[model samples]
Structure formats: structure tokens, C-alpha cells
Target: MTEKTIFPTRLKNNDYKFTVWAPKARSVRLLAESPKLEITMNKEEFGYWSLIVSGIDAGTRYRYELDGNNSFPDPASLSQPDGVHEASEVIDIHDFEWTDDEWVNIPLDRMIQYELHTGTFSAEGTFEGVIARLDYLKNLGVNTIELLPVAQFSGFRNWGYDGVYPFAVHDGYGGAKELMKLVNTCHQKGIAVILDVVYNHFGPEGNYVSNFGDYFSGKYSTPWGEPLNFDDTNSDEVKNYFLQNALMWCRDFHIDGLRLDAVHAIYDFSAEHIMKQLAGKLDELSQQTEKPYYLIAESNLNDVRYISSHSKGGYGLNGQWSDDFHHAIHALATNETRGYYEDFGTPEQLSKAIKQAFVFDGLYSKYRKKTYGNSTKNNSGEQFVIFSQNHDQVGNRKHGERLISLSSFEMAKLVAGCMFVSPNVPMLFMGEEYGERNPFYYFVSHLDEELNRLVNEGRKEEFKTFFDDKGEAVNPASEEAFERSKLSWGIQKNPEYQSMYNYYKKLIELRKNHPVLQVPDKDKLTITENGKGFTLHRWQGDRQILAFMNFDQNDTELEVPFNQSGNMDKILDSTSTNWNGKGETSPQKIIAGETIKVAKEAILIYSN
Candidate 1:
């Protein structure tokens, strides 16, 4: 089941066998410094050229000279130890130690995911820095860590979506060695690592693929740049470049899964789409390794085909980001009913999303003025990863305010309880546990002055029409904005922040302890509205847990519909007053056929 090795065996000879496709060039030569030498390449069909020069090896600085004027780095460079403007550095993938042979697969249903950007997750902003906080994550009950893209970009400071070198790890994050270390450490801790990858398009800077061939299609376009040439001629290589990169992360870095970014923007008219190909290859790799390798696409299409199995005439991806679910919950929690939020906000929309994993389902979108999204009714809750807040929803905002910053602490707790107990994988953004007030603003360090100005101007113009004067005025490209986005870890020591952190930790523990909550059974779960309050119920074995939430500002009464016979006990409550103001015991309660008073902006779970 293993993919056929592109490189059959290690190159033992000191001579470097370099190969590249340069059809436009009459001649291509490999030039190296230190041990200065030049080797002529034998031209092959499709503009490919190769050369084997003695005394050249890994770590040797080398560049390809095209037509004796244009010089570019290797398209499939093993390492870009120096910046892309500098020569490429080669490295051996086989040179690392790995553990975690006995790790068993944790089903998506059981995953409590945490999303982080390696550059910002810690003060050091390195992979090794994240390793230092493994115990904190384990204590928080996070089973999966979804990292933002670590691929090489123009400079050290970036959000990682604009990555150019798919294979090379950012040097700022300790490069390849640190990447392997991060994955291996996570595996040892029984935590699965999923990478957020950008395959829709490359960044505007440091891209060398176009020089090799027509890597982009003029036929299609993206907001960032031109769409990848998936439908054009000689796209087989272009597609392979990304497909191979995906496999490399799983195989070389031992990454457990991949979250494909912005699949809705990935245009492809080919009979066999690139996504299908990637899933097919991943399936083969998973079988070969006897381990689970999952793919999660961040698609807004709601096409159901994205999560359907390949055997059932679909893309065969494991799951998706579930933006509809986020939209529904976000609009309700924040009460910001603008833009795409226009389609959600009501209890009906939120309840539908919580129960059915989709809010639209081929319904008309007033914003787009067209029917959007297909039914996800047949898809299990496990097929969707639900979140109250994520990088995009937070950073894309004018102020990049987190959930805790936008709403009260009580509302944040209620939101977490709803998302965590829902029939879907719950994903928490970094510092979410303690309600980190620092923003997660979009940041980049591009040297191009005109590009930076355009980006800054575009951001302001886009926000001018919707947000307030304060939110619309701030320049996203400013250094002050990026500095303000860093997480304030000191908040963890604060009593208020610590309380919220404990609340999330307890909710996660409760989710794991209750079999009904852990395994999302779309059939057994039911949501019933009671004016300003809602009751969510789930049955596991002979026992059932009742979850109640009051969204209104005042205390509300909810009448139970089910028959009550057994002695019911309070299991979990989000209210801070219930625990005797921290570390004190409180008596449990049971009620039968009575009006249940729910505290304002609080969630409570009852079991018998």
C-alpha cells in the first residue's frame, strides 16, 4: 500500500545528481560556492535537465543557472536553510529518531482539538517551544493539536497561509529537526497532530515554480493570486507537487492529519480532482503504515461530497471545518448579525446547525442572492469539526477580538459547553481555555513596499463599510497591529482567567467521562427550545444526561417533556457561584416534573 518511492535509494556517491525541468532554457547548469564547480545538465523531454557532479553533497549551497542569466532555487528543494533569495540546502529525511509505535487511533468523535500557530503559541515561536507546554495541553484534555501551516514563507513573521515552499519547514521554527521533534513529542503524549496546509495558491513572493513551467492557470483566479493550474496542460506535475507535499508531512514528519485550507477556492475542472487524488494517496499510506492518517478540508461549499467516502462517489475526506456550525453559534453568542451572519443568529438556525451540522442546506442566501450549500443531513456529526471561534473568525475581524473579549465570561462558558457537548469534534483556539484577551490579527513581513501598501489599503477599504470607525481605521499591515496580536500568557496566572480555564477543562473531562457525550449519535441527541432557554438531551445505555442553557439575561424556567422517575443528580454547571467561590463542595439536586430554573447565561448538565 506504500506509495512507490520517488527516490528509490539514498545517493551514496559524493556527487550530487541534480534534476529539474527547464524547457524554456537552451541549457541549465548547477553552480555551487565554497567548493566552487559547474556541471552541465543533459536536456530531456518536457524541459527536464539533470547533472551529477563529484564532491557535491547535502548542505552544499547550489543554484540552477538558466540560459546563463536567470538563477533560481530547486523546485523540490530538500531544505531552504537560507532564505529563498539564497541558494538551496539539501538534507536527508532518513536522519531522525522516532517513537510512538504503540499509539492507537483516537476516533474523530473523541477528539478535543486545539488549534495553534507555532510562531505564536509560545514566546520563542518555535516547535521546541510548543514541546515545553505538552503537560498544559494534556491537563486541558486536548487530544489533537492542529497547527497552522509551518511551510517556508518570505520572512520569519507570517500567518503561514501564504507559504511558498510546501516541503521546507520555516527556519524560524527550528526547521526540519524541530518539526520532527514536535510531531514525535505530541505522539508520545497520545496527542494527534494535524497540519493546516494551503494548497489553493502560493504566496506572491519567493515562488519559483512558475519559472519551471506554467504552474498557474490564467483560466481561473483567487483573491490572493492566480489559481493553481489543476485543469491546464502539464498539470500532472503541478498537482503532484502538492500531493507529494501532503504525503511528505505524514510520512516524513509523522503528522497524523492535514486540514486543507480554503478548498472552496481550489478550482479544478479535471475529471479527477486534486483533492480526490490526495485522499486516495492518503488512504494507501494509512494502510501501509497501519496507522490512521486523516484529512480535514476547510470548505464552505457544504457540498457533502467533501466528506463522503470515495466508494460512495465523493471526495473521501475524513471531515471539514464546519463553518456553518461556527456561523450559527457565533452569531447567536455575539449577537452580531451582519455579513454572512445574516443567515444565522436565530435559535432555529443555531439549533439546526447543532443537530444537523448545517444551517443552509440549499437554502437561499440573501447576501449572495442565490441558493447556497447542500444538505449535510446524511453526514454524521463526526464529519464536522465545530467551533465557537477560530483563527479566521477572530483575525479577520477589524479588531481581531476573541470570544471572551466580545462577550461576558458567562457567555464564553456557555458557548464552550454547547460546542464541547455537541455531536461534533470540538476545536479550541490557542489560549482559549484562559480567555486570552490578546488578538490573533493577520500579520506578514513582505519586503515589497507596493504589495504591503496594497494589502494595508485593501484591508481598510473592506472594513470601512461594515465595522465601526475604530475597527475600520487601524492599519492591518502596521507593526503595532501585529505586536498587539501576540498572546498574553501572563493571563494564565490571573484568577479570573484561571477560573475560565478550569471551566473548559472540567467540560472536556465531562465530555470524555460521559459515553453519550463522547460518541456523537446524531439520532439520540435532541434540542428543544423553551423561549429564552434550551434543553439538550442525550441517552447512553440506560441513563440520560440533560443539558440546559439560558441565553436570556434573566432567570428562566424550562418545563421538562420527558417522564422523570429516577433520582437525578446535578453533574456539571458553568455558574461560578455554584462551587462556593472556588474549591468548595456544593450539594447536588434532583427534580421531578417541576419548573427548572436556569441561571442567566449559564449551562448545567444533570444525570441520574
Candidate 2:
């Protein structure tokens, strides 16, 4: 199951064992630093050039010289201490002292995911800086921290998907050493670390993989440009190249899981798909490490085949980002009717998303004007990670509007309540728990001026057809745009913020303490939509729970449903004065057929 550890030019017994794949090159050489050493590499079969040189060890900075004149950073670089354009550093993966010896598997079912962008999550924008907030995150009931890409990208500020070197951790995020420390600290605090990785395409800047060999295909087209050469000639090595990167994250960094970005955009047409190969390798890694390692895909396909088991002729992944759920609630709460939101915005869609995993399961998508999604045959609800808001949902907008700015405070609580009580793994964006209102604009730094201008234009042009002013918004290439996306940590301490934060904390506690909320069984859940709103029903054996949300502006009475009629006890009411809302006492106990007063945009949770 484990892949062969290749490239990396390891140092053993005072000699540097150099190895690289450069098929397109006529000649290749190693230019090492600290002693100014150069060795003529032997071009072996399959275009692999390698040579064992003496007097080079850990911390030995080096670069691959192509055609005896042009030097580029190693494609399998361990560290890029001097930034992406500079020489790559030879690192000893075993040198870092880890403290997670007793650390085992973090069960997927017990996870409360918190998605964060490293640069924006903390002021320092480094892996070490994340440690300071571990206590805060641990107390916030987030068992797992799903970081956006930390790989070395073009600039100090980016979403991380633009990373060119898959193995090199970004220097801004404390490099490889600081990343190790972050993972170690997370494990020490009983938290799992899930790393986000990009493989669909490399960033436009500092990408030199094509100089050595064919890493991209001229045939396949993607939104970003040429797709990865997964099925082209010499693609076996290419697949191994990315597979080695995935293994490096889990095996070298001790990361618990990986979230693959935009798999739908990863065009691979082969009998043995690249994703299936990667998933199979992960199975080997999970068993070898004896940890419950996980693989999540951010797929827009909405096909259950992504998470289906290998035996079922599909890529066996852990879960995928269920945008259907986010869209359902977002359209319901905000009432936006542009772009993809134009097809949603209905109570029935929200109900379908809750009861079934995907709202568009095999149905015709009006937005696409075609059939969308496949039935999730036997896939559990927990296989989908549902969230009220995420970096993509909020940051990709015209002005990067968050739910707090788009919806009422009561509606925010209602959406958050659904996320907590739903029978699915829930995730929270970095500042969503405290209702931070800063925008998460998409920004990047490209050294190429012409390319940078094109990137800005493309971003604006894509939004023009569906949005009015979305195309004429702020330029993402500017420095001020990146600064504006940074989280305003001070505002989180306000009384208004604390009230919602405390509600989130208690809701997480409710999920952790109760078994019914943790188990995501679609068959055990039910949803009913009325003229006023909808009531979701959840049950386990003798215990039962019902969550009601009133969307009507005027207060209305909702009928509760239960097969075995009994008095339902109130657990949490968002209308209470404690939440700085209208103080209305929803009866502590109500019979199955009895009605309960539901305030405007009010959220009520009852257990029996």
C-alpha cells in the first residue's frame, strides 16, 4: 500500500543520494551549495537522472541544472527556504522530534471540523502561530482543523490552491519545521489535522515542472488552463509524483487526513483513474500507520461514486464537501437568486438536503439545464460534510459577503443550529463561530505582470454574466484586498459576538454529549415543510429530537410530530433573552399534536 520513496536526494553516511526525473532534458546536473559542488548526473532508463555525491547532508541547499545552464528548484523539494524561485533545501525528515507516539486514530464520526486559511486565521500567518489558538479551538469544540492549502504558493498571501510545489510547505506558514510543530501540537491537544492539497493544476507563477518533463497535458482543458497529465505518456511517473506528495503529507508530516481540491476539474480519462490509484494508496497508508486516516474530496459532481468503496468499482474516499446543503440553507436564509443560487431557494430543497444527502440527486438541474447527481446508494449521511459557511461559499462572492452581513442575526443562529443538529459532520469557517464580518476575497501574487493582469480580468469576466456589479468589483491583485481579508480578532470579544459564540459552543456540546446527533443516518431522519417553515425529526431507539425553524416574518404556531406521542422537552431555544432576542418562553413540554409558538426566524430544538 505504501509507495516507494523517490527523488528528495537523500543524504546517507556523508553522501547525498541524488535522484530526479527529467525525460525532456538532454542533460541534467546537481548544483549543490555550502561547498559549491556540481556532479554530472547519469541519465538512467525512463528519463531518471541520478548520482550519489559526497560531502552533502541535511540542510544542504541545492538546485537542478537543466541543459547545463538553466537551474530550477527540485520538483520534489523538501523545503524551499529561500522562497519558490530560489534553490531547494535538502531536509532530513527524521530530524524533527515528534511527540505523537501515543497518538492514534481520530474517528471520523467524532469530528467537528473547523476550516481555516493559515494566513488569515492568525496575524502571524505561520504554522507556529496556530499553536497559540489551540486552546481556543479545543475549547470551541472543534476536534479537527482543516487547513486550506499550506503548500508553497507564489505569494505570502493566497488561498493555498495556487501552490506549484506540492511537497514544499509555504515559507510564510513557518516552513516544514513549523508545520511539524503544528501537527504535533494538534495531536497533543487531542485534535486531528487535515491538510488541503491541490493537484488539478499548478499556479501560474514559478511553475517550472514542464522544463524538466511533461507534467501538464496540452489535450485536456480546465478553467485554470491545461490539466495535469494524468493519462498522457509518462503519466505513470506523473501519478507516482502526486502520489508521493500525498504519502509525504501523511507519512512525513503525520497529518491525519487530506482534502483534495476540485476533483471534478481534475480531468483524468483512464481505466485506472488517478483518484482511484491515490485512494488505494491511502488505504495502504491507513493500515500501515494503524491510524484512521481519511481522504476528503471537494467534488462538485455530487456523485456518490466519489466515496463509494473500492469493491464497488469506485474511489473509496471518506467524504466530500456537500455544497448542496450549504446552498439550500444559504439561499433560504439570504434569499439570493443569482448564479447557482437561482435554482435553490426553496423549502423543499432544504428538506431534501436534510433527509437525503444530496438535494439534486438524479434530478434535472435548472441552472445546468441537464440532469445532475447520482443516487447515493447506501452512502451514510456522515459521508458528506455539511456547513453553513466555508471559505469558498463566502470568499468567492462579488464582495466576499459572509452570512452575517447578508442575513439577519436570528437567521445566522438558525442556519448554525441546523449545522449542529443535522445528521452529518459539521464544519465552521475560522471566524463564523463569533460572527466576524471581514470579507475573504480571493487574492494572489504573481511575479508575471501580464499574467497577473489576465488573472484579474478572468476573475471579473466570469462574474459578469451572472452578476451586475460582481464583474466591476475590487481588484484582487492589489495589496489592500489581501489585507482586507484578514480576520478582525478584536471584534470577536464584543458582547454581540460573544452571545452567538456561546450559543455555538453549547450547540457543539449538545452534539458531543448526545448520540442521536452524532450518528448521521438518513433513514432515521425526516423533514416536513409547511407554509410557515419546516420541522426536522431525528430519533434513536426510545429517544427522539425535533428541530423547527420559522422563516415567516410574523410569529406562527407549528405542529410537532412524533410516532409515539409524548411531551417533548425543550433543549435550546434561540428566541430566549439569553441570546439577546425576544424573550418568549416556548413551552418546556408539548404533546406530539400540540402547537408551539415560533418567533420570526426563530430556531427551536426539543428532545424526548
What are the lDDT scores of the predictions, listed in order? 0.80, 0.84
TM-score of each: 0.94, 0.96
Candidate 2 regions with alpha-carbon error over 4 angstroms: 1-4, 9-14, 470-472, 553-564
RMSD of each: 2.7, 1.9
Residue 283's lDDT within candidate 1 is: 88
Q: Which candidate is the best by TM-score?
A: 2
By summed lDDT, the worst window of 10 consecutive residues in model 1 runs over 1-10
Error of 2 at 102 (Å): 1.2
Candidate of highest lDDT: 2
Q: Model 1 over residues 1-608: C-alpha lDDT tens digits? A: 11222221136664456777565678888788768877678886555677666765556777888888888887766678778667877666767888878875577888999999888888888999899998899998998999999888887778888778777788889988888988889989889999999999998888887887767899887889888888788777677778878888898888989999999889888888889999998889989988888899998778889889877778899999888888887887788877778777787787788888888889998877888888777788888998988889998888888988888878888888888778888999998888888888887877676877887888877777556566454565577666777678775468777787788888999888787887877778889887756888888788788888777654443444434667568888777553213221322666666556667777778887
Candidate 1: where is the Cα deviation over 4 Å?
1-17, 44-47, 52-54, 471-473, 554-565, 578-587
lDDT of 2 at 507: 89
